[model samples]
Target: MELEGDLFSLTNLRNMEIIDINTGAKLGFIKDLKINCEEHKIISIILPSQTFKISLFGKNEDIEIPWDNVKKIGVDVILVDGKNLVEE
Candidate 1:
């Protein structure tokens, strides 16, 4: 299904939650984006920090989600298939 709405700005995407469609798990909020400047396209979405927990340490490895895995963009959350993502 195609999503319909006004174009989303980076600021708008920042406020959205990312969910894994395969397991219905909350991934995390987007912390950064990787763009292919030469191709003028988004390469991946970068998620920082842990999901739903406060880590004792100040850092956890960032999760890099390839753009191809993204399935949908809803009003509140972004749906993605993360089953194939490599575990860090």
Candidate 2:
């Protein structure tokens, strides 16, 4: 996916899913992306929840997966190493 130019452009990133490589489980959708200010590279991914938990204070938390853990980026999903993902 060629994500260049306008950062807010949702043309290429609507309804994309992020998956766990080890188990092939659907983690969440791509809510937004954080880019590094100096290097201009993607620093982390944002995953807004489709469901909510009361313990989380009723606010959606974005799952910040560091760029280094990303194993691959696929057409429909972004895959990451499962061992590094935090469990609930």
Candidate 3:
């Protein structure tokens, strides 16, 4: 469920950057989303996988930021506390 009076458009969300507060890293942009249709809640935000030479041999996996990890949503960035839970 959406927080009371808290609403955001997917297009705007996609336009904002995701920044990690702990490491001050620009993890990446929001690539996609995982949502819970039955519950009407967002599960997580997806980010493109980190670049690696290993991808030449295997498929790259994208990163996910749980909804609970999101700390703030600003005009240009989404502040997150993913920390070590997310790699730079």
CA-lDDT, candidates in order: 0.82, 0.64, 0.80
Model 1, position 79, has a per-residue lDDT of 93
Candidate ranking (lDDT, best to worst): 1, 3, 2
Candidate number that wins on lDDT, 1 or 3 = 1
Model 2: per-residue Cα lDDT over 1-88, one tens digit each: 3323334435445466778778888887776777888997877776665356445566664566666777766566667765665322
Model 2 spans with C-alpha error above 4 angstroms = 1-10, 49-51, 54-57, 86-88
lDDT of 3 by residue, 11-78 (tens): 98999898888988898899998999999999899888766534555756778888889888887789
Query: Model 1: per-residue lDDT, tens digit, 1-88?
Result: 2455668889989899999999999987999999999999998898874544444685666788899899998988999988876433
Weakest ten-residue segment in model 1 by summed lDDT: 49-58
Q: Give the least accurate 10-residue stretch of model 2, judged by summed lDDT.
A: 1-10
User: TM per model?
Assistant: 0.81, 0.67, 0.80
Regions of candidate 1 where Cα sits further than 4 Å from its true position: 49-59
Pairs in steric clash, model 1 = none
The most accurate candidate by TM-score is 1
TM-score of 3: 0.80
Highest lDDT: give the candidate number.
Answer: 1
User: What C-alpha lDDT does candidate 2 achieve relative to the native structure?
Assistant: 0.64
